[model samples]
Target: MPITTEPHVAAKPALTTTVAREYVHRAALSEVLLTGWNKTGRDAFKVTAQWPRSHSFYVSEHGMHDPLLLCETVRQASTLLAHVGYHVPLGNQLSWSRVQFAVNPYALRTEGTPADIQLHVTCSDIRHHRGMPVTMSMHMEAVRRDCLLAVASVRFGSHSPAVYQRLRAGKGDVNEVFAQAPQPPEPVSRSTVGRLRKQDIVLAPTPDRLRWQLRVDTSHPVLFDHALDHVPGMLMLEAIRQAGHAIEPARGGAVMPTSMDVSFNRYVEFDEPCWIEAEPVETAAPSSDGRRTIRVAALQSGLCAVNATAELTDTVSL
Candidate 1:
């Protein structure tokens, strides 16, 4: 895929430490992007994050940060605010119901230093259970040196341990399901998915060009940072993004996912074969710059696991 490079900006000094890994549910501090945050008003805050110039994943051509990186950053910030700002119990599990992100291609740039980020976040549609917030929505703007990089939002719900346990109704539990999952099928060519590393490619070839078998790699360091009973929602988001790339005829990595609006309908199981399918969003108006749009769906057991509309652009919009 072709990517436009922006003028490099010098790094400015900022917070030096990341938040606790537990707050963001990350097993490694190396994966944490949030640096600090402070409450500004009721259900509002100012948060800071930093993106590394070089990461194992989350980068496109010319070192421009990938949009998925921003997605992950917002995901982390959401959990952090829930745990510390909202006082949700540490043991409670948070899951996103909806997630959307849009980026300006010009703002995805880097020199030799990390990108220092500032986000203004506000929460809404809060619903409480037992005097604690059980569900909420967050909207945030990601800025770098006064430049608007991206804007994103997430609607998520938090469930207590007991409630979460009851929600699991599959074969055995998550661990057993994960253990029984078949070996990951061979992935398509790294170049086909616009990935430099083979392990990062998440699609397996199928006879039908518009569809692919979802390749689940539970051992992947970043996506599967910790074990769970089901496939992580982020992984499904990624599968759709890749599906958009492959669904385009004659466009492999050429069709790159720049922005995505995803609604996770159900948990994607580990032991079953999940299919990623894509279709063009003909009703949706195209961007002035001629960006292609596609709706991708994850199908497991003939049911939609996720429904997402992804905007594709030739230039890097991460």
Candidate 2:
């Protein structure tokens, strides 16, 4: 879809009116509501948003729904009240300045499909320092039933008086699209005692530099107690990340990897340690807001176990 920023319209309430008739793209909301997660008109200060299908919103090819896109959805939903002249003062504004998600592994599989989901988000506080206005804090949890799928938080900045006027006039140059931020280099940490170990260099990080070592312990989760067996793909990625951290500080300011495409070329089993060497195929660059992307590759035991690129940013709040 071409980029769009529609002008805000006022709404009116009346007797004998349908809910859909009172909202934008009611059909879309209807589909989302069918997923059984919406709670509309339940509270004077709260509202709900939902989608029936993953395709209803957006999904990426790397085996998961794009986290950045979901974050954007939450931002838009939260600001809908302000745009629709709810209790918020006229000209009040909110833009997602940061967001982060710590996701569960099993939920990772259902992400590409239209499974039921709900986001419970709350505004914790807002404050200002000197003349720089800052909206305090807000957190969101994506859940199915009582199980937590993901936990996220965001920070927003209210618009200034002049900026709000421009927005109302439909001439605002503001873009809520967050630009990716430069990912910080992974941090250095102590090495754990393990059966297999090797050191290598990482050329590409969301930040300019990254490097680390690969230590393998097939015994940690002994499959058969014979050999280490093939290392789980996710575990390998985790090891790569650990190695990367050795080169620099963990990208604390970075939005954790929302999705990853990994190709397993071979396996690193228990008895043998897999040494991985990694580097960025591309350098990090500025994204909307303060986010960034980095492309990286890894070699295990001289064999390419996984090769992939990752998008990273610090704009996301945790």
Candidate 3:
């Protein structure tokens, strides 16, 4: 995919130890989507960024900013707010409890456009204990050139480093879990996956109509950018997307996801065979525009690892 080399116009001064010391994420991981932030009030912040041609986690094969990246953006922005506004001791890990992504019909592609993006983040709820923020809720939007691209609602819980370490102690080595990369399975049909390329297909249908096996290629430059002990949450989201596409009729058109609500119940182990099962959720009435809702789950050892509900609409009539 092509990438733009133009620098972000609103890029802030390089992060320094003093500024990042209290950040929950460090180094490249700490690079917030926002170039700068202003405290609008006690519970609100105005954050801005010059949309970049590419991002480490946001870029996709189509050269557009993947919808999933907005989740991370909301995450970082939320943490930044907690640290800047509440004086919450930083360096605590945060894990998503619930996430909702609603894509605007006029979402912009970042491949070749230069646009200014702004986020207005408001803290909706904060559960505190012992003078520390234990959980937080935030609502934010990504607007480009006065057009809204997406809006996200997120709830997450903070975990201190010590607590996070203790929780992960028994997880064993992540590298070891990913050491054996499985070969790509037989490619599913383009009509079935809504993807033209085999490499992009994340689901391999099984005899059961509603069940499919998760397919992963560790060498995949984007999906498996680095060795991970468990399946990345983004891949699970992709699986949900693909599963929805497969079950929906193509006569209406290509599937365009409009909204998604996802919850991560547990880590999906890489060494185990993760199964994806999708079901159509009944709607009160048929959508005139060919929109449908799908509920998908990623299961391992018969236990749900992730649960997601996605709303998709046909892009064009066939």
The C-alpha TM-scores of every prediction are: 0.89, 0.38, 0.76
Say which prediction, candidate 1 or candidate 3, comes out ahead on TM-score. 1
Best-fitting candidate, scored by TM-score: 1
Q: What is the C-alpha lDDT of each candidate?
A: 0.84, 0.41, 0.72
Ten contiguous residues with the weakest lDDT in model 2: 193-202
Q: What does candidate 3 score on TM?
A: 0.76
RMSDs, each prediction? 9.4, 20.4, 8.6
Q: Flag the better candidate by lDDT, 1 or 2.
A: 1
Model 3 spans with C-alpha error above 4 angstroms = 1-34, 50-66, 79-91, 109-112, 178-187, 225-227, 249-253
Q: Over the full model, what C-alpha lDDT does candidate 3 score relative to the true structure?
A: 0.72
- Lowest-sum lDDT 10-residue window in model 3: 16-25
Residue range 114-228, candidate 2, lDDT tens digits: 5545667565565754544445555666776567766666555566666656644533332311111122233233332111122212122233235333343333321112221
